[model samples]
Target: MATLLYGPQHDPIHIEDRALAHLKIVIATKLRRNETFTLSWKHPEAEPGGRSTIWIHPSIPLRFVFDEPEAPQINVRWVEELMHTANSSGGIMLVDEVLDIGEIERQH
Candidate 1:
């Protein structure tokens, strides 16, 4: 598990570590470009039965904490999918990663 600590209030939004890793890349890229967007995700089974969305801005304080000692291998295709939605008016929607078999083959 990983926690996304957003803003000064430090409201903790829990997410799976793998998802968080991909999100971190997309979020950082947008913020670096001075772009703002919203991130939406459904609540995990452990949390209440609802979805949550947050406005991500360049100036806001954001942090990603992972329980794993090392970062997981990133999925470029997943990041591209996220970047596509991040640019949309509806903003980024958190979705499960679609394994890229081609990418894995290229890596090996």
Candidate 2:
């Protein structure tokens, strides 16, 4: 698992290391251009049944931590889908479903 600490008020969002790595890429790209958007995801079972949303801004303090030392292979299709959501007015809402990290690499 990986942890994404956003600001000081919200609890850390736990995500799989693979997804976090790619999310890091997508998020960094937007923030680099000073684009702000909402990121929503289903809360972990421990957090009950609701979803969580955070306003992602360039000014906020954000941290991404990966459990593994090596980075996961980037899934281009997954990233494109995620970016599409991020670009929408509804913003980026992550589904609990995770893509197979190896699946993309094997094709190339």
Top of the candidates by lDDT: 1
Per-model C-alpha RMSD: 2.4, 3.4
lDDT of each: 0.93, 0.84
- Kindly report which residue stretches of model 2 are placed more than 4 angstroms away from their true locations once superposed: 96-108
**What value of lDDT does candidate 2 attain over all alpha carbons?**
0.84
Per-residue CA lDDT of model 1 for 9-44, tens digit only, reads 999999999999999999999999999999999999
Error in Å for residue 108 of model 2: 16
Identify the leading candidate in terms of TM-score.
1
- lDDT score, residue 95, model 2? 46
TM-score of every model versus the real structure = 0.91, 0.84
Tens-digit per-residue lDDT, 53-86, candidate 2: 8899999999998899999877777787788889
lDDT, residue 70, candidate 1: 92
